[model samples]
Target: MLDANLKTQLQGYLTRLQQPIELVAALDDGAKSAEVRELLDEIVALSDKITLREDPTGSARKPSFVVQRVGQPMGIRFAGIPLGHEFTSLVLALLQAGGHPPKVDADVIEQIKALPGKYAFEVFISLSCHNCPDVVQALNLMAVLNPNVSTTMIDGALFQNEVEDRQIMGVPAVYLNGELFGQGRMTIEEIIAKLDTGAAARDAEKISAKEAFDVLVVGGGPAGSAAAIYAARKGIRTGVLAERFGGQVMDTLGIENFISVKATEGPKLAMALEEHVKEYGVDIMNLQRASALVPVDGGIEVKLENGAVVKSKTVVLATGARWRNMNVPGEAEFRTKGVAYCPHCDGPLFRGKRVAVIGGGNSGVEAAIDLAGIVAHVTLLEFDSQLRADAVLQKKLRSLPNVDIIVSAQTTEVTGTDKVNGLKYKDRVSGEEKRIELEGIFVQIGLVPNTDWLKGTVNLSPRGEIEVDAKGQTSLPGVFAAGDCTTVPYKQIIIAMGEGSKASLSAFDHLIRTSAA
Candidate 1:
């Protein structure tokens, strides 16, 4: 159950309940069921407005519980223990079900309430996944806001049979109305856009109507946030357009290298960044992807994918980088079937299964070390003869009994039928081909800059990174680039922020000089 400190915190949070709520549990006599019962009892003990009831005939999933308003139908359900990353989701579900107002925008709440058809969303997640809570919490909030929507957060680890039967090889696998909806990290806006097909067109129209910005930031990662904040602080019109705020940082787990802070999670840090940016007069736009950048008569006009255009006096390109794909055969076809990129997000789905790590860098070695604890075995393939990871990490990886390492190995193909069953590789030393049977493959090779859209518009390096001067100025005047998308050496979050600030300053200086002339 909950510790004394945790119980005290839960009790404090329970004070926010404005109305009565019920926890109707559908549990068996197993150990997990007993644990669930104890948890429910402890929860009810804290709040007078909360009640617990056993509903053995409620859900087919044992050790499950439903959170709903008193005398109302169940809206949010948990099919497994809601601990670890999902603990926040559980708390939010309680507060939302108890008539506490959610922090979501008023328009979004209204949109949820207006949705036409009934939606039964079931999301499979692992407690260790950093990305699962966002999906779970979003759906839970939707369920609480709209009667037509109901959601169940199923822990894939606890329900092995269901996971196997559904062929779910990744965490945060979502299903709507008994069919596969999507697999991977998704935001509430993204989810809504998917459900409400007209949202994109409406959003595009609204974006097209916005006035020009003094400094417009593309991409909402650490770099974009810093750039927007710096621009806004200068008493200028600032705006940020992002496909999704937080960029790769949202997919990240543990972040210890950020200075001043001892350690923090990615989602937590991302939230802080967003909140900090919102304190200023900067206009924030989310779920907007830039299709092309065109240098207009006075400023640059960035076209959206939905045929809308946004003009800005100066633009800071901080679109950031994405996980590098192997580009081998069967890799694309089997994605989410057995191939995955984020180890922290998707590792739990492959528990007790053999998997391969496709690099020898720090990320690869670290992934192998982490997966060795949960997975049956790990085969690490390195293109280089010697591992490039830190010596400490290499030592730790070698100590793992279930891990194997291959040097000068080139991944030939990802082999499988319906899902990934193995992989083929070539040994440089022996000039021989080999194959290893594995249930999953984790690609930790590196990152590719998200500069494809700006390829013809901006000067790009051989590796497809935007080439920037010392002032973070790109070849195009009044246009700058920062963060992982640029030729900056280190792609650390702190470096990205600093680079973004520098880019903003440079863009501002350019504006002054041009206006003076």
Candidate 2:
């Protein structure tokens, strides 16, 4: 039910409307003032063109509009945020509010859906957080598909108290019966499994750690896989947790520099490495993420968002960094075709073609140098006043026969019809604009630390890199951070792998000391 202030506002509108007015995300929140009403009216007129799902029961209301009618009481309900994973939840809430009982699949899903029957569920999420939205939408869908379900969302930013009271911890935390219990990204299937837990009991089953491992590695990148291999070899029961079977290394199209392998694709090398580590009896938890880390015994306990926590003696955080995006218009539309982050992955596809490299730093110049040898021509554009690379590298780049360096120039647009055929540039000084024809664009604008989740928990450099000792030991005992994400520089596959192995050894030594004590 809406509070008094909100109820009065809704009632005033109910009196003026002829038919039921459709409610939408923008309108229900009072963001639509009189000035925006006309614009909204136009959008509503085109609503039929928009596709919508139907619920046999009205409890799951469609988002076309929220209605206030004559002689109607001003009772209101909130539909939680629909953006990110919560978007699916918004649909579910509308279904329940309109009067339909959504049939749940997994016993776990139903268990979560059938909260304590008192508090509402509010989940906040962002699209940037990749896996955060799934958990919320699963709950919302279950809530809407069921009659007794009446969940709603509060503005996460505005309703800080609501979040705290519910112990809303992170970007994607769920309020169950209006209480904060556990937070992490959960899939519909996983939630359903949780809801359907224990057909014998009609509720979710709670279990303790399977408790058979020491070090659990997260990510199958060079660091993670290497940690698993080393830990297992040292006679420590170990497991590897990776979102993808192979991390970014597998996505890397080419690697001419890994020792002994001469030239190979990142995926090929990762596959071979995967086989090598398996021989050592390392258990791989592929296609998964670490959802919770509970401290226990000699190390911390590891819990996956899939609702399974394993007991371990130590944890190695090796989650690698993701590619940076330009965030400009159409950059996403033509990513692999015209705009590329991994030059080695798609560089061969652009053989004898014209390409542009954005960034004036080491990566930018290195990519320019690499592509120059294969492409017809390479244009290196730098936004900085001057290239800040080392003199030796700068001289080497200048000497490249096919390279052209454009400094103090800003790229305004990556212009093309379907694929990247040209790029638009602006002169910071002369204010002149020029468009150059190119088939490819590689961006190396620097790297952002993917260690935001570990601040006070781990020692980090001023630049946010995880601080590792010579042996990859973090300040906190038993908590090891590795890979390009950490302080180790020269972000190459081999270096990250070596660091991972070292960290695993460090963790093993720490465990051994504790066990002997």
TM-score of each: 0.99, 0.52
For model 1, give the RMSD to the true fold. 0.7
Which runs in model 1 stand beyond 4 Å of their true positions? none
lDDT of each: 0.93, 0.63
Angstrom error at residue 1, model 2: 74
For model 2, the stretches where C-alpha displacement exceeds 4 angstroms are 1-209, 253-256, 291-298, 305-307, 333-337, 344-354, 360-377, 385-403, 412-440, 446-449
lDDT by residue for model 1 (1-517), tens: 9999999999999999999999999999899999999999999999999999999999999999999999887579999999888989999999989988999889898888889999999999999999899999999999988899999999999999999999999989999999999888898888998999999889989999999988999999999999999999999999999988999899888899999999999999999999999999789889988999999878999998988899999999999999999999999999998999888878888988999999999999999999999999999999999999999999999999999999999999999998999999999999899999999999999999998899789999999999999999999999998999999999999999999999999999988888788
What's the CA RMSD for each of the models?
A: 0.7, 17.1
Q: Write the per-residue lDDT of candidate 2 for residues 133-161, one digit (tens) a residue.
A: 44554555655444354344444444444
- The candidate maximizing TM-score is 1
